[model samples]
Target: TGDLLPPLVHLGAAAPSGLVRIPNSNPGTPETLLATSFNMHQVTRHKLTLAGASFRVATTPLLTCDDVDFHPTDILVDADGSLLVLDTGGWYKLCCPTSHLWKPDILGGIYRISRKGAPLIEDPRGQELAWRHVPVEELLRRLADPRPAVRHRAADQLVSQSQRTEEWLDDNFATRPPAVRLQLVWILTRVGSDNAVTCLRSLLEDDEPEIVTAALKGLSLLRDRGCLEAARKLLQHPDGAVRRNAAELCGRTADRSAIPDLLAALTRTSDRWEQHALTYALIEIADVSALKQNLTHQSASVRASVAWALQSVAPDQLQAETVLPWLTSETPLLQQTAQLLTAQRQDWETPLADWLQRQLAGGGSVSSSLLAVVQHFGQSEHVQRVVLAAAASDTLAASARAALIRGLGKSGRHPIPQDLTDTVVSLLETSHPELLQALLDWLRASERSAAFNRRIWPKLLAIAQDDHYSATIRLQALALGGEERPVLPKPLFEFVLEHLDAEQSVPEQLAAVAALREGTVSPLQRR
Candidate 1:
């Protein structure tokens, strides 16, 4: 035991483990010293030295049980010569693998030791008991105890009183058994809040499948926007399970951008169970084109998956004479499948658009499926019908208006077609702030002749005063006024100056300054 001193000193073992240092207050000199340690016999020793000569004291044996182990974790000695030792449990080595033996009596004991002259004085059991500080390992061992009561007590200590929660997580999160880490992720994420959100996010990329699942489930419980972003990034994860979880999260949020990534995942990954989960999520988000090719898969399950996805994409598009046979069977799955084939008419853009045009003519609102059809058939006559329908409905009006603005703005130096202008202006007159801004943008396009500005000045002035509009729109109006200059209002100059001097955005401010100078300085005069 005494030969252990050199190795112990080399390891700084004599310098108390888990000791807290308090600095001395005297100016220009080092301060008070307090050191504590717990010996292998479960005896705690504390030393306090002030101005150079101080007393040393220790606690008595913390445990009296026979055949007890002597691994202790912490020690502290008080001014009254009372000692405290935290008896941690012991470890055992087997031929196959090392194991642990948790001794409750050693961990539960507290002792007080004293020194009389040179020899030590010890009481196995003292009247006065030092505060018991149990090792966190012991508490965690209790969490794994067969007895429910012991597990509950240890859990309460870990969660409520001890500062060992971090220690528990650090110890277990990296190397513990899969099931243990999984449970820890759940508990930590629930009780940890934002603090735990990061830890769980890290576990999302963990190697173990069950650990990743547990982390994903924990993130679901968090419901944080950052967590959602993390999940979105995981849509590209190499692991199928991570990709599947990301798809599931997108379904829960109904985020549209996730559509493309989920589509890609469904096509590339072959895991049937995960594929099924992704298929279900795709259906919820109204995006099914991803599985379109799988409609002819030899496996019934794969074929069924494709069938459902296709039905969602263009149900009527499949209704044509040749493909309709697929849906003719009478089973519930096949009946729904047939309805989808009829909906398959949606697959071929022109027919679906023509169908949507007829539906519009008959006074029915365009279905979302039909709108999807319109997206594929960019220039069909249904475009004209959709324009007309949007001219009629309030919400559809802006989309109708945006399509027109984009189309005309893209058309360069052609004759100013009256029909295009009339359709645009009519839509623009009733358009929202976005539409008004888009129209002004089209009129001022350097690609188009400065000619359109002469026709649109009145509408431009009307939108400039629209304080409900965005600053970008307002700035655009100022630029249009400066560019056209057919008539410049006093407020236009003041607005430009205000933007030039006060706005922090450099581009807009520079544009405003240039516009203000250009409006005041006539080019003809400079020439």
Candidate 2:
């Protein structure tokens, strides 16, 4: 057993467990010794240690326990002098007790440690073969190697010599096993040559679903128009995954011609996830005629998809006859979709405002959906009604009120109505931080208007000087006050200077500086 208390060992102690000597063929080179240190959690090599440990030939470990818990059990020196280390992945204690115990078939691994830059003495497993000079046949054979590292190395070598490798794969693709064929398709994509598209297309007709899917993925990477056509045919493939993959490939290629195929898939597919994929693909292609045709489809999902997709399409082309019907659709998704589309058009502003006013006057429960229309299209007259409703409605959500406040700020460039100004000033006493912040933002945006500055500035100055409010609200109030030129009393100026020298946070100090700069003296004069 290796030493257990490695934490107390002197720094750089080998704590060597499985030590093996590598025979040197050339006497001129120093003798090489390989050992695993359980304490250091790595396999290291050294030159012949006679008294103390031999001077380190290399400081970096030959192999590190980066992934697995490598409690190396034993080390073997092959007849050819290559090193093999047996790692007993001590992961049982690391897993939950209720989980399945470690299976040796999956957990056991053998790591090969071979010296590079020099040939191994009489190696038989082709260990000494240079990757660049390796025959295409030899590299292809290595694709089926039991170890992933070997397979990856073989693939990398094949990719480097891609022209020759592509020719070889095209010549013998049918004779290879399905497993090997899959690997070939993967490597061809990495080769990224004109030949890859041709090869990937042939595999699209393979009997296996996995092979077809792999081919589709490979073709998507090429982004050729021919690949887009191939993917279009797979939209109706029997396998759902194949269809989904095809839809995604069409989206990535962005071929507008695929819109009809995507819409056809959207009609027949009941799967929610598949429908989402097709919808996203349609959105990316954005063919206005194709999307408009799907608006009246019986599936609420399809109608909703059309609604979402239309947001990106130019608004000028959307006729009222095509868009207005979806606004009254029973489905919430369609209703929201219609609202967003309606909000983007300036011509629809009057009609949308009229609808909002009717809903409010009828004492209807103003849905956030309805409020959104007002927020986007409302002007001065509309803002007066919404502000009054918001101030009067106790059942209104804070978020809805905040949205309305923001909408009022954006309503018009002219002076705000006195009633709306009074309503906003009254909200400063509100306890809800979100509502208060929204009110402050609105006040700041409207501060340039003389009427707004005269009405709101005094209320802001009082809130900033009040110590009972939290520092965050006070800072917001101070910032809002700085947006206008309100005459401050001497005590207010002295009050701002006091905070600059006190044990205040940086934000509070910044707010104090802004207040002095606007209310008392100019910042340029102070500098």
Candidate 3:
């Protein structure tokens, strides 16, 4: 029964039996192969050979059984010719670990061998084909045979051929049907020779989409310098698929000059697939200038892609500020683009603040996206300046105040500047109590002098006394002062002390007390 030891060979499922057959009969032994489950996990099985027939021993010296890179395609023969081991490439080939493996243009290859002196026939069910010793050249000749069987065998054999067959491929390209031509393109790419490069380049002007697709696939596989150049030029090809493929190829090339072509492709195309592919390619290049330039593209889709692309290119350059005003643009697409740009490059905060000021004057509402962008610029002096400016505005000013307070609190740079304190104090006097609390958090976060907080403390306390003070603001004010309400100017401090004793809800009274206490504790003291 052909050295039968194990009754079944597991394909997808687990092999439970620990015994297998070994070919080649060794002297004094029946010559059986043993398959032992390596661990209880049942995922890996170890193979052992029988020599004199007492027990099994691993034949490989100085290495653990696990050191081997086992695959189903590999066949191991024992020294005594007693064992024939088979590891099919099916698992490895299907899972495709080597698919992305880095191999030089020429050294890597996969081949099929047929020992029957004829090519291996495909399994009728269309699952897989394997055999012993069939040369790829023999298969190529059969591709032109009059018989359909001869052609199918030849076509299938090309699947495992090395990428070095580009010259042979070019010579044969004209005779093959469009379908086989496409297959040849794929085969030639794996060959990765200069001839393959030329073939793909020639296909750039092809009228058929399949031909162009094959060429693109070949170029992508070759990925040589010439391929990169050809792909860059293809960005402007009359066909959309060519243009789209060119963008995709550029992403793989990672060449900087490809950036301009990718950007052009992004702007010139309106089809969503082309736009999406081009956007990703541009982002992969990490080209900041290209992103900024497209911020003004005529298509809203292109404009949106510009925003997505900016995240890939860090806005480290000085010119990023030039695009800051787009953050306040009425067009949502441009506004989204500007927001992402500002978030990455804090250096743009200065110009972004300026833009917001202009927008406020133009009667624009502080959109959430703009607020998010400003907050991401982080709590720097520039950000603080904008926050304070926003706090000082009358309409749509609450959003700005909220952004400033958040920036100051989370910015790791607690204690806003004394100048900021001066602005906050002035705004509190005329603004709603809600606005005052927002300013107070920023004031407390800033490590300003006692003198700075002291100067503003009186004004904040007086706001606490106004019966109109909401419970939330009243509590914030009390926290600022505490039990030992310090004496201050009669108008502000006296107002606070009276309010602290006023009959109110506990939360409101506490707020007044807190504000009184905060007045004494300088930002530095609180820290």
TM-score, one value per model: 0.31, 0.47, 0.50
Which tens-of-lDDT digit does each residue in 167-256 have in candidate 3?
Answer: 365574565555456556655666556666777677666656547755885676566557687778877777666677778778766678
lDDT of each: 0.50, 0.65, 0.55
Residue 437: error of model 3 in Å?
A: 4.7
Candidate 1 — which residues are off by over 4 angstroms?
A: 1-138, 143-172, 227-243, 284-527
How do the residues 1-527 of candidate 1 rate in per-residue lDDT, one tens digit apiece?
00011111122343244443332212122222233332223232233321111122332332333433544445554433444555444542232111144434444444444454633324322223222476766665544443333444555556564345665554435665454465566567646645567778778777775566567766765654566666767766665656666667776665666655665665565555456666666676665444555456544444555555555655653344333433334333433444444443445445544544454454334344344333333343345445444544554445554554444344342334333444544554654766675565555542333455445556656666677776567667656654555535666656766776663587668666555553334454334
Candidate 3: minimum summed lDDT over ten consecutive residues — where?
1-10
Expressed as tens digits, the lDDT of each residue in 201-264 for candidate 2 is 8888887666787788888777756777778999988877678778878987888888878877
Cα shift from native, residue 17, model 3 (Å): 29
RMSD per prediction, one decimal?
24.5, 17.6, 17.3
Which has the greatest lDDT? 2
Candidate ordering by TM-score (highest first)? 3, 2, 1
lDDT of 3 at 79: 27
